[model samples]
Target: MQITASTVSLTVADVAASQAFLTAHLGYTVQAAADGFASLTRADAVDIVLLARGTQVLPPEQRDRHAAGLILAFTLADGLHDQEKRLREAGVEITMPLREEPWGERLFQITDPNGVIIQFVEWATSDDT
Candidate 1:
């Protein structure tokens, strides 16, 4: 199959809040927007779609659902610490402080306004481990 692109759609109680958070902090730009929906994109990151909770476009069984227990993660090739510092300088709350794992993973997390966890990760080299 030939897949061109991918996007993650998040059903949030406040679509605007999530949209704003992504655009302001994560460097996402609005690709499109409507009363209850918004499409955001970043040049080198995953695209995001924000849908209001209970949006009519959703199937009846899923219309009331909200994005919970989901961690949208991005794996960066480098600069994890610099990115964390930039986020902190911008006043974005760091839900999970920077830490390194025994498995050579360095990461941190932040909670969006709607409580969706966003994680940034970088793998450590053998020397750094």
Candidate 2:
């Protein structure tokens, strides 16, 4: 079987906050939205769908702790620092400032409302801001 597209949905307490964070920091475009549900997609087809917990998916406790551990990881084809600047300008708190991994990749991190850690990485130097 071939997996063409995939989306990981999160049961969120506040849809607006989640939407705003993703849109403002990561440049995700809203593909669908309502009072209880929302879907944000990136140009790379990465999707972040938000739904009200206990109504759309599981309870708050059942959410994958993976989000807290790794949260979400996004690869940046554009300049990593520039994106960091934008997120910072939007008042988004960055937990881990831009740092280079020993593996030779440039990466940074932030946390969402629920304390989910989000990661951004650049694997190549071709991306110049």
Candidate 3:
């Protein structure tokens, strides 16, 4: 009578590469791995899966074209500087310079090997609020 999303899959050039990124950079635990697929579980029961081209139950054309790269949104617990330091120490490439939004958020974006955008954000107090 009810349904909920348990997992989300995104196409990657290489499953191992994506797996390594999540493991090394984000500290997610790798739950499963196969020839061309890997699954990772983070806190709060969230699971992310990487399916390399030519694999997975998703459409063949979609895999072949690698059309379903995703936006992996991450919220920072500490301040913006802390997030910056962590990502910087990991040697992650910064696609857009960090910017403060008028709505009171400090956000930055970077893309992974599979062309998936990873947006990192932290709360920044608004000037008027």
In terms of TM-score, which candidate is stronger, 1 or 2? 1
RMSD of each: 0.8, 3.6, 2.6
Candidates in order, TM-scores: namely: 0.96, 0.78, 0.81
* Model 3, runs deviating above 4 Å: 1-5, 67-69, 126-129
Which prediction has the highest TM-score against the true structure?
A: 1
Quantify all predictions' global Cα lDDT against the true fold. Answer: 0.94, 0.78, 0.76
Clash total of candidate 1 = 0
Q: Sorted by lDDT, highest first, which candidate order results?
A: 1, 2, 3
Per-residue lDDT of candidate 2, residues 19-109 (tens digit): 8878876779999998868899986856888876556355567653233344688887768899889888888898999988766688889
Candidate 2 lowest-lDDT run of ten: 62-71
Model 2 quality (TM-score): 0.78
Between prediction 2 and prediction 3, the one with superior TM-score is 3
Q: How accurate is candidate 2 locally (lDDT)?
A: 0.78
